[model samples]
Target: MSTDHQESVQELDVRDVDGEPFEQIMNALDSVGESEALRLVNSFEPVPLYDVLSKKGYQYDTEQVADEEWHVTIRPE
Candidate 1:
């Protein structure tokens, strides 16, 4: 038998949290125990930023939001 407890995407709004600065968001992640929740960033940059975050061991998923914007969901590894 299969269970039906669908885990919906928990969207932690970045505008309300990060504002714009990535550093401040990282700090917030640290304070809140990164593993406890996920973070979503609304930005378009693909390579450089994702590269840095990957190197830091943050597992993330991305989706296109607009013409040049994307929404990234970040979670702890």
Candidate 2:
């Protein structure tokens, strides 16, 4: 996506999740507006979240930033 598109997405960084991260992610997703997206940053690829979000009518793109880091952009389809 273009930098401008990315800039408008609602961002969520979960690399610092104290315990469970799923809840935090779900909350963010819930707050995403129809015209907005949720950008998730994590220390590792959040595989399970892909399925969960997909079932909720969200499409996602994952980019590996480092060996153990990933950036996932989720948007309503």
Candidate 3:
């Protein structure tokens, strides 16, 4: 997969979820396709997750749309 911009993606919003959403996020990423992406919506930027994703051959871009809103688009590299 070229990892080009993909329209087909899975969006997982964890803003109102209870407890930690790490496992939930991981599971979501696990099901993501090679040519697709995982859009994570959260209350804060998941900076620590960058390393984990990078190690898994994935790259991500984080954008803070609001004081407590962040969006990370994860794509396979």
The local distance difference test score of each candidate is 0.61, 0.88, 0.90
Write candidate 2's Cα lDDT for 1-77 as tens digits. 45545335889998888987999999999999887889999999889888888788999999998998899999889
Q: All candidates' TM-scores?
A: 0.57, 0.85, 0.88
- Candidate number with greatest TM-score: 3
Best of the candidates, lDDT: 3
Name the lDDT of candidate 2: 0.88
Model 3 spans > 4 angstroms off:
1-6
Give per-candidate clash totals: 0, 0, 0
Error of 2 at 16 (Å): 0.9
Give every collision pair in model 3: none
Clashing pairs in 2: none
Q: For residues 1-77, could you state the per-residue lDDT of candidate 3 as single tens digits?
A: 35456468799999998989999999999898887899999999888888999888998989999999999999888
Question: What TM-score does candidate 2 reach?
Answer: 0.85
Give lDDT tens digits, candidate 1, residues 18-69: 3456676577556544335455555554455677678877777788878756
